[model samples]
Target: MEYSESECHYRIKIILIGDVAVGKTSLLYRLTYGYDETIRPTTGYEYFNKFYLFGDEIAQVHFWDTAGQDKFKSIVTNYYRKASGAVMVFDITNRASFESLKDWYKELKKFGEEAVEVIILGNKC
Candidate 1:
């Protein structure tokens, strides 16, 4: 589809949150740039931009990949502001990772846009 600048109306900002080693980066890579065997862990945060066709409208999607380490929680939380959506990821084999979903959800609601869309992702299944 050919999309002009004026045809872009929807702007979607998505954030990915999960504990360390939960494969959040891998998931983002697969979605935005296809699979890569050399994907590395995100340090603090990373941003990716892509455009998609939603019916007749062109949507610009901004994906933010946040670090899952405790030390980076504060930094990660900052990116939640004005987020249009979020993906809370967890490792299927790790119970603790799943348990942290509630905390992540709470943070997303507390800091992100009130009408933000959310989805849970179980990785390594």
Candidate 2:
């Protein structure tokens, strides 16, 4: 978990995007802070940082959890500017959330770096 500056091989910025109440915040909470029964929607954005080892390389991962509300779309898209990767989350049981993935993908492609990697997450599955 500890790596000297020279030992670190990668620094990745990851952004999470999805429709409101789709468990984006909950997923981030579990990843960074462990399991919590209480789930709250993100207001604007929340960030978490951690280090991981990949074989002999060390990577610093930055996770940006953005608010999923329509009102916060602009703010969330702004954070996508320099993202190295993105996780587009959707609730498996919610048809609307799945429908919104196209919009999210458009925004991601527009604001994020051209080479940014993307993964689709079916949350609450």
Candidate 3:
């Protein structure tokens, strides 16, 4: 089969999940929106669009920022189930936050299985 040079395209959905004030929103903004330390946590879930060009095709990356609070646990957990990849964040300055990584890992595992790529981030470390 002869292929033309115009059919390549791909899209990726990534989610950022963690405890409150763990820098999940900060990291996403920093990387995606070019946000700095001044950026604040997303109250609930925020969406960001990222586009990349591959050869002559354009790939879109849809990023979902999930809340990092226990009160929103169920809602956040449900989001993780559909995540193709996840970024788990923790604040290095707080030992308690760092310690919560284990629980975050467990929860993420239950929702995002091995098929979902995980990136653990320790901010201020």
Name the TM-score of candidate 2. Answer: 0.92
Tens-digit lDDT track for model 1 on 59-108? 98889999999999999999999898899999999999999999999998
- What TM-score would you give candidate 1 relative to the actual structure? 0.91
- The runs of at least 3 residues in candidate 2 whose Cα sits more than 4 Å from the true structure, single-residue gaps closed, are 2-7
User: What is the C-alpha lDDT profile of model 2 across 1-125, one tens digit per residue?
Assistant: 46665777998899989999888888888887899988778899999887889888899888999999889988888999889999999999999999999999999998889999999999895
Per-residue lDDT tens digits for candidate 3, residues 1-125, read 22333443767788887789877777778777685767776777888767777777776677888887788877877777667788877888888887887888788888875789888888864
All candidates' TM-scores? Answer: 0.91, 0.92, 0.80
Candidate 3 has a TM-score of: 0.80
RMSD of each: 1.6, 1.5, 5.3
Local distance difference test, candidate 3: 0.77
Whichever of 2 and 3 has more TM-score, that candidate is 2
Which candidate leads the pack in lDDT?
A: 1
Count of backbone collisions within predicted model 2: 0
